[model samples]
Target: MVKSVAAPQAKGKSAEDKIFGANNRAVALSEKLGADKVINGTVGSMLDEDGNLIMLDVVQKAYKALTPKEIVAYAPIQGYPDYLEAAIDQCFGESRPEGYIRACATSGGSGVLHHVIHNYSEWGDEVLTSDWHWGAYGSMCNDNGRKLREFELLTPDGHFNMESFKANVSDMVAKQYNTVIIMNSPANNPTGYGLSDSEWDEVLAFLKDVVKGKDKNIIFVSDVAYLDYSGEKHECRKFFKKFGNMPDNVLIVVAYTCSKGFTMYGQRMGAMICVTPNKDIADEFVAINQYTSRATWSNSNSAAMKVMANICKDPAKVAELDAERAKYFHLIQERADLFMKEADECGLKYLRYISGFFITIPMEGSQKVCDELEKENIFLVPLGKGIRLAVCSVSKKKIHGLAAKIKSTLDAVGAKQ
Candidate 1:
């Protein structure tokens, strides 16, 4: 008989409301710089002009001639079988390492990272990576309640720091966490540094020593996203063979992406590879990874799988795609070279490693500099340590002008300070 008591409305913001959502650096820079027609190197977005669109048509025609599937149905949770096989073949190439290799299709390189962290690592576990890394590494790990640990990334000679790497691995082992070490090699992101064979030997030696007698479980996840753009294919992939007869406690996961290699950013195709000395481990990895994929994405894009499968299966089409990829790779290198040269002429102090589609400019007040550059119709990503400049999408004509713009911005800002 009594009137229903009305529930009090919430007085304050929810937890989601408290959280900062937008990328403030990118957003502020975009706004101050006038986002409308600014040239961008922030995200790895490739803008295909009329010419590039025409090239895509030619590639599509080749694909149709080979495997002409009109409609694409849902792919298996694990992925298209033929597509997975071709991806593995393309990665390993002629030199197949002696290990039990299994792969699972992922949304993209970042998707593979998400699956590995969510499925394999426990809450509050630690992941060790380079101090300077792709920003998303921290975002993904923190979202999953995992702690990211880092060590200094370079030596005095501007090479990979094996000593610092060993120290960090040994510390993680001491903490008794199921350690996951992600090595973004052969042109690491942000900095663009690769490990030499001797450097690899040192790191491997440390791993062998750390997990020598203990039953500790260690996973090495190699992010080889920029493999094709490294100038030398076989030389860059040599690290994969080193783990051929790896220890039972140690497993290798290769996160391979088609975004850079195949220029299929919209397709969102990639793979999570598990390499182990035992077939049983490989089987277990596949089963658990499939569960992770189901719980999250459920299934991958069918059209992407179909197109990739068609291209991989046809030898002539594969050759043609490779040639096309090489053309872009060379263009990226040319742009990077020109930008570096311009930076040198301007007396800019940048990180000395350059091997990929991007480079980090070591300027003070990177955010302010980025903002100033945006006013001039130029855009770049600002990192905690430095500013990341992508030289891939911009034209050769834009390279020198962009460098000059950056120099001017820095000078003006410096004078104000």
Candidate 2:
């Protein structure tokens, strides 16, 4: 007889996520064969032409310069104060909305996401996001015993599906007391897609309308994990200003991560920043999320927090970090440009790519085509939406005309639509 074990939430729990599986295969193949012989686009983090993981000069210097005490000591449960403020400023830039704002330290963006879903959404209730999204969102929801509701990510005109979003949001609001929505942009994972300023306005307008005369709560989150690599200074954060003057029932949360921004993937430093027109909401946010922090993970990294705070607060250091990052930023841009140009030439249609680590090419038989591509030493992760090509991690040498190869493979396998 099976012994009584594991909670109900833990029963029938299993996920053989193909993304990580494919990534493992890619890394194994790269090791078995030579790295130069393979186009490994499976990993989401940045890598250079020599197949080296990117490390920001400022992060290395600032972190190493920390005292042994800073490295070894315990931090405040919510996060060191400086790190919390820096994380907020890093997310909003000069365009921070005029509203009450607060932040708490987290293990990483994923930690913040977990807290958001757990605290804001009812247990066993439904949450929402776009059809084309980072896979981890689904995992986080599933782990928390919440259902994921997805809407079309794009319209026929290749813009944000505002109508579909409104329809889904309204449907959920009618049924659920709290509707939590995740919107990742300025380099959405698995799809290099970013909504324009006007598109953002449309989304806000719809959300504002949904809150009108309704008792439901709106928890809108901006998953800004890759904000730094998304675009130019101030440009990537222009959407934040729109969050000001929002209704009291609406709460905007931005999940900020040091992993992608500072190239400190293992440090596991992140924060959750909340924005609201009401002071009560802001105070309640700090109270509730801070308690959640204590219950789970406790606090984030002290040394890493100090490092980021030092980098952000110092003018000279900030400039140095910016200059160092600009070099790789442009390198990523060049890679994306080459791949997109080739895709256009090869007649391969992909999702609208404003700027991001991924570009999803829409086609059927994603798994079949991806497996076939592996034989030719070319690797990418396939999603239900499409095949995700990580432009940020691939080199220019391999990116040039790579789309043509993918198209050719699709044709050979009769996977082309």
Candidate 3:
């Protein structure tokens, strides 16, 4: 009788998430087997060598200095002006494009997806992204009553598949009034691949060709959640300059987040930045997305915004924060270098990895492989085509020969063909 009272869409909906399910199992196993013995690679959150969550000292210092009003008072629905400015500066740096820019406070990069999916695209429209992507894109689209369409992420020769990208975007724009394309680059999660500047040229050129004279709207979402870890700071962001002076119909949305960038995951602070040559479109983006935010979470954390502004406003604070993040970035790089070297030596195959929190190894029966790995107290999250290992969460010493161990495990499971 109670089930009969639920709406059609809400019926049969449960709260179980696959990634979280795997993470929970990892937690239980780690407690029983001891943390040092287990390789916990279930999630993207950065962890120290001792299996503790990482928090930047400078970020902590900045946040702890906030006043009570900063903690409790309601912030503007669009976000505080100073935080908006900081988000812009932090995201684009010196290579900021020549366009009108503004940000709407979002819960995280996930919130950016929610706002764009709800505000830009119509109902029943399928959002487009690459095949290898963060799993939440699909979750967010499904929850919004929309769907996700993916094109091949890489070509047979290991390059960005521009042909597939163009074909998919062109077809989708033909069907829908607005086509939203989300590209996770500059340390893409789970795969760690970032497009080169030439690839960016191809992407922008293709987009310009797609909507040359058409009235169709193209919302290009560049999700740079892992940008800070990708490569050299300024070089990685040079692509942002390419967004300037694009056609009025094309709007660039940067899904900027403090969760990864500033190590403030729990605070859930970030911004949905819109860049466009047309000033009116930028204004509309702020208005509509803020309306969506007001109707959803109402407002963001004020203390986090204040801390972000404080860090950005002070030159010394900026350098301290940068150096703090840089230390962890190098730590993760060392872990990855060791693992990649060992994986190569052992002849184990994985996706192309740049520098990021995760790397994926291809294997059949993902769930089964993950289950078998648990017997060794080694936890990894299963994906559609492989298993994702979060190098950012595992230490260099533990990662020394993880690849060989996994290879041995695959052979034992009769999956190493």
Candidate 4:
């Protein structure tokens, strides 16, 4: 073989995003057979009843009104001042926890993940998250020269598995003095699961105990990328208050993104909001993440930042945006509900789903089932242990009977449930 030129660490890297691969196949089939005949459930974004991408009306208008300077000018490495403030205000909503909070704009929620994995963990250290997590978490950890360890996400009765969580976390903290723990919640990806206030309390209490006598640091990251579509605004955010007055060693970072919430997927606007009782740590958060931002993407999208700032600063615009988002939120929820109801009636098992865009069905030979489903023009993402159906992209009419179809597909493939 010819001598490789890439750095040793980068040599064997290949792009194998199965989700996008499956989507490409779905799109091709849609073109061949027409859109109505193909059930394309491989998308990660929201699609309307007619299968068109849904962009918020308010967001579109704000973008249209932006001046050329606003659209083209570079944003501060730390993001525009107003945008940072608005990000914090919007992220916390009524559940603004008491802490020395700070925000730094990132390229997107993915950028926040990149920064946290790079800055918080040591090389070769294991970053902790749930077993049934967004696949990108593992990819990020691998890219950052760290390992990703997972705790069992759910128990036998379909609840948060606290025992497994504590056990795995204790092991990681014992091995590595500092551990970065990522909890994607208020609508976790793939499973559509959100922890309740009581569940949050259990997690915090466990972390508090883990650091009782050790020189340890726990960087808790909340990936709230789907928070807007999860539930009622304030009601869904109540668990945020649990972050208040944490041990100085336990730092909470909320990775807030406008991709799903504001329908600004292409804009790549997001922020990393840190909550800590220590002012010094909060200040250090901004200093370090901004430096990373400069080294990474240099700066975020200025037009998206300005649009958010302008909309957030005006109450009327905020109201309009909220109403528009709520409309789509309900639409997504209705689609989720329809599939869930059918799943329940058909005795199809799924992970505990509270609110979010996707729902996962646990099974063996998931890839086989997904491939078989594709033969029927029904496209879904196959996870390691389950099939992730994008309820966000499927319309209510199409969502109906989907559970039954999947159940039959699972049986046809001889995939164990």
Point to the candidate with the largest TM-score: 4
TM-score of every candidate relative to the true structure: 0.86, 0.97, 0.97, 0.98
Every candidate's lDDT? 0.75, 0.87, 0.89, 0.91
User: Highest lDDT: which candidate?
Assistant: 4
Per-residue lDDT of 1-417 in model 4, one digit per residue for the tens? Answer: 867899989988878899999999999989988999999888999999999999888898898999999999988999999999999999999999998999999988998999999998999999999998999999999988999999998998888999999999998888887889999997888898888788899999989889877789999999999998888888988889999988999999999999998988888999999999999999999999999999988988999999999999999999998898788889888888888899999988988888888999999899999888888899999999999999889988888888999998888878998
User: Residue 295 in model 4: shift from native, Å?
Assistant: 0.8
lDDT (10s digit) by residue, model 1, range 193-264: 888888887787678779988878788888988887776566667777877877878888989887777767
Model 3 Cα displacement at 92 (Å)?
0.5
Model 2 Cα displacement at 282 (Å)? Answer: 0.9
**201: Cα error in model 1, Å:** 2.1
Error of 4 at 330 (Å): 1.5
Candidate 2 lDDT over 1-417, as tens digits, reads 666587887877778887778878888888988899899887888998888898988888998899998898899888888888888888898999989989988888998899999899988999999999888899899998898889988886678888899999999989998899999987887677888999999888888888888898899999988888878878888999998988988899999899988998888989999999999999998899989988987877889899999899998998887787777778888888888899999898887887778888888988888989999988899888579998888999998878999999888888865
Off by over 4 Å in 2: 1-5
**Model 2 residue 5 lDDT?**
81
Candidate 3's residue-wise lDDT over 297-328, tens digit each?
99999999999999999999999888877888
Predicted structure 3, TM vs. truth: 0.97
Which regions in candidate 4 have their CA more than 4 angstroms from the true location? 1-3
Candidate order, lDDT descending:
4, 3, 2, 1
